[model samples]
Target: MYKIENLSFKYEKDKYALKDINMDFSKGDIIGVIGENGCGKSTLFMNMTGILKPNSGEIRYNDEKIKYGKKDLYNLRKKVGIVFQDPEKQIFYSKVYDDIAFTMRNIGMNEEDIKKRVEKALEAVNGSEFIDKPVQFLSYGQKKRVAIASVIAMQNETVLLDEPTSGLDPRSTDAVVDIIKNMKKNGTKVVISSHDMDLIYEICDYVYVMNKGEIIKAGNPDDVFMDEKMIKNAGLKTPWIIKIYNELKNNELKNGETKEETNLKTIKTKFAQYK
Candidate 1:
C-alpha cells in the first residue's frame, strides 16, 4: 500500500541518514527491517510517518504522493502510526488510559468512541488488566504495551514498530509479537525493526537487511538469510531455525539418508519425530 522511491535524507550537511532507499509495502505483509544500531531503520520510519521529510525522492501511499501540506500530512499520519523504540519517549500521559486516549482526544473523538477504542487497544496489547494503572508504576515491558496501545487506538492502516521486543523478557517479547500478529489479523500492515533474528524469521513475510543507511538485501526470510556474508556484514546472525535446518541436513547426509531441502515446517516436524 506504500511505495518509496529513491528516498534520501541527511541529518547533517556531510552525513546522510538514508540513501536511495526504495521499498514497496503491500497489504497483509509483515515487513521486517534488521540491522545494527545507527543503520537508519528509525530514520526510514520517521520519513515514512512524515516526522522527517526526505531531502529528495517521493513516498506514495495508495497511488497518491505524500506531501507535507497540512491536510496531507494529517491524513498520512492518520494512516501510518509509529511506535518508537523507547516507550518512555512516547508515553507522555501519567495514566495508561489517558496515554492511549491522548490521540483520540486530539482528533476530537467523542468520549463514547474513545472509551471503546481505548479498551480495545489495550486489550489488543494484552494490557486491559492494567488499564487504569499509573504509567510510572508499570514495568518497562508494560510501558511498551501502553506505547503500542496508543498506536492501535489511532486505528492507522500501517504500524511501524522500532525494536518492539528490545529490553524485554521472553514472555514480554512473546506478548509484543502477539500484538504484531493481531495487527496483521486486523489488516493493519506492520513494518517492524528488531535485533531479534528469530522473531523476524518467525513473523515477517518479507525482510530488509540494512547496512549503513542502505538496504543490502531484501527478500523473503529464507532468501535474505541465505546470504551469510551479507547477513554478517549487516551485524546480524542467521536465525536459529536456519542453523538447525543446516545441522539436520548435515546429519542426514552423514547417515546416508537422502539429502532433501527442507522448509521450516518440514524441519520442525522431522525434528519432533527425531526427538
Candidate 2:
C-alpha cells in the first residue's frame, strides 16, 4: 500500500505547489487523479516517487517511513515506477530491447536474467516483434508501448502514469487502456493522472478531484461524476452521459420515469427512445 500523510510542497518558500495532501492507495485499485493545469497533480506524483521531496510530510510504502538518503531513495524509486507524459523523454537506448533492459542493467541484474526479463516485459506490452528495431523508427504509439515495457521490466509494485494517453490516436488510446486494465488484473497499484473524462469513467475504480493544490473530492467514478458543480469548480466538465442525465433530472423530462430509475443503461435507452 502507498500512503501520504499531511504532504505539502512549495517550489519557492512563499508559493505552494501542493497543500496538505493525504491519501492512501492499495493494490488492485485503478485511481484517476484529475484537475486543471498547475493544480499540483503532477507535483504530488513526483513527491510520492521521490523525484521531489515534500517540504513537510510523510510518504510511506507499506508501514515503513521513507528516508531521503541516497540508498533508501534508490530502493524506493525501484519499487515505484513512473511513466512520464512524453514517451520521448523516457526513451534513450539505441534499440527497443536495450531501452527496456536499461533499468535492469543499471541495477546490476545478471546478463542471462536481464535477457529473460526483457523478453517477458516486451511480451506483456505486445512488443516482442520489434525487439531489435530502433526506437526512433517506431511510431508514436509503439514508442509509448516500449516506454511502458521498460517500466514493466523493473517489476515495480506501484506504477504512476502521467498522461499515458496524452497525444495518441483513438486506436493507440485503446491499446494503452488495455495495458492499464491488465496491470490492475495482476494486482499492481496503478495511479493515473489524466484530463480525459471518458478514460476516467471507463477504467478508474476510484478518483481524486483536485483544485488549486488540494484534493477537493474523492470517491467511486459514478459518485464523483454526479456532482456537476463540484466538478466544474475544479476546472472539469461532467461526462456526457452524466450531463444528459442531470439535464433530464432538472427539467423533469421523464417518459413516465423517476430519478431512481435512471442508470447508465437506462440513460442510454432513454436517449435512444428519442431517436
Candidate 3:
C-alpha cells in the first residue's frame, strides 16, 4: 500500500545512499529487497519509515503524499513500523513486556490498552511464555522475536524488517518466518531486506534485486531468480530451485516448463522422474 518514486537519499554531501529508487508495494504481498551490504537496503527502509527524508523524489502511502508535519509524521509512523537488523538497536528495555510496550507508552496509550496490545503482540510472536523474562537472559532467537514483538505491538499496517533472520538459527528463522506469515494472514503487509536467498524464495511473492542503490530486477521469485546474470550482478546466486529447474529443462528433460518448487523434498521427488 506504499509507492516510492524517484526516491533518493544522501547521508552526506556528494554521497547518495539511495538513488532513483522506484517500487510499488501492493496490499497482501510479501516483498523482498535483496542486495549486497551498502547497496542501500537499510537506507531505503529508513526513508520509507520517514526516519530520514529523501534528498529528492517522493513517497506516497494510500494515494496521499507523505507530509513531514509533526501530526502527519506521527500518523505515518503509526501506519508503518520498522524492526532493525540488530535486535540490540531496537530492544532497550530489560524485560520482554516492557520492551514491547515501549512504543505504545511513548504514544500515550493508556495502561489497559497497552497491556492488551503487549499481550497480543508477544503472543503473535509466540514469545508470551517469557513475557516477563529479562532481555539479557534470552537467546539470540528470543531476542529477535522480542524485536519483532515490539513492532507488532504498534499494530502498524506495513512492517519493514531489515535482515530479520540474519543471525537466527534454523528453528529461529522458521519461527520468524511463521510470524511473518501470521502477519500476512492478519493483513499486515511485510517488506523484508535479507541476504538469505532461500528464505526470500520461500516467503516473498515479489522480489527486488538491488545493486549500487538501484533495483536491477523486480518480479516474482521464479522470474527474478532465473536471471543468472542479474543475480550475479546483484552479488547473489540463483536459488537452488531455479538452478535445478534450469538444469533439468536444458538437459534430457525437454519440452517441459521449469518447476518452481522451493521445498527440498518436493524437488528431490521431481528430480526422480528424470533419473
Candidate 4:
C-alpha cells in the first residue's frame, strides 16, 4: 500500500530528523512503529501523509509516485488519514457531529452522503452517543474517539495513528484497541506509532524499531521483541511477557521456551508449572 525509499528529512540545515529510511507496507497490514521521543516517528508519518515533504527520496502508494504538489498531495491525502497524538489538536468543530462531518464536507460529499458516512463512522468508534454533544465538553477519551470516527468516516485506504492510547485509563485504552482491531478486520492498512510496547505486541502484525532517526530493527513482533539489547538500545521496555520468558530461560526452567512462545498465557502457564 505504501513505499518509502531513502527518505530523509531536515527541519534545519544541520538538524536531521530522518535518515535514509526505506519501508514497504502492504494493504490490510497492521504495522507498529516504536521509538523514543524525537526518533523521527512523527516526522516519517507527516511525510507519508504529505503534511511535510521529505527533503529527499521518494514515497509512493500503489505504484503511483507522490509528488509535492498542492493538488496532487491533497488528493493523495484523501486516501490516507492521520490521527494525531492529541485529539484536541485535531478537533475544531463545535459539535461532535460537525467534527465528524467536517472532512466529508471538505471533500465535497453531498449532504445525504455525508450524514450516512458520519453515522457509520460514529457507530464504528462507538461515539454515536455523543453525536450531539459539544466537542469541547466531551472527556479526553471521548474526544479521541470522535477524532478516530472522523477519520474512519473518510473511508481512507490507509490510516496512520500516532499514540492512539496515550493518557487514557485502562477502559479507554481497551476501547481504542478494539476500534483498531475492527479497522484491521475491515481491511484498512493500519500504521501506528507508539511507545507502548504492550499495545504493539498485542495488535501489530509487524514491528519496526527506530533509534537515532533510523529504523534499527524491523520484523514480526516476536522477533523484534525478543532482542532485549536492541529494545534497550532504542530506549523501549520489553513487554512483560517477554521479560518473564527471559527470566525463565535464564533460570533454565523446564519448558523454558524461546520468545516465540512468550505470549501472556504461555508465560503464565510456564510460571504455574514451576510453582
Q: Residue 253 deviation, candidate 4, in Å?
A: 4.7
Q: Which sequence of candidate numbers ranks them by lDDT, best first?
A: 1, 4, 3, 2
lDDT of each: 0.89, 0.87, 0.88, 0.89
Runs of candidate 1 with Cα error greater than 4 angstroms are 259-265, 270-275
lDDT digits (tens) for residues 1-275 of candidate 1: 78999999999998989999998887237999999999999999888888899999999998899889888898888888989999999999899888899888988899999999999999898889978899999999999999999999999998999999999999999899999999999899999999999999889999988999998898999888878889889999999878987787777778866756555679767756874
User: Cα RMSD to native, each candidate?
Assistant: 2.0, 3.0, 3.9, 3.5
Best by lDDT: 1
lDDT (tens digit, per residue) of candidate 3 on 234-267: 8887777777767655653464444542444566
Q: Relative to the unseen true structure, what is the C-alpha lDDT of residue 111 in candidate 4, on a scale of 0 to 100?
A: 93
Model 1 residue 57 distance off true place after TM-score fit, in angstroms: 1.1
| TM-score, ranked from best to worst | 1, 4, 2, 3
- List residue ranges in candidate 2 displaced over 4 A: 247-260, 265-275
For candidate 1, give the lDDT. Answer: 0.89
Q: Spell out the clash pairs found in candidate 3.
A: none
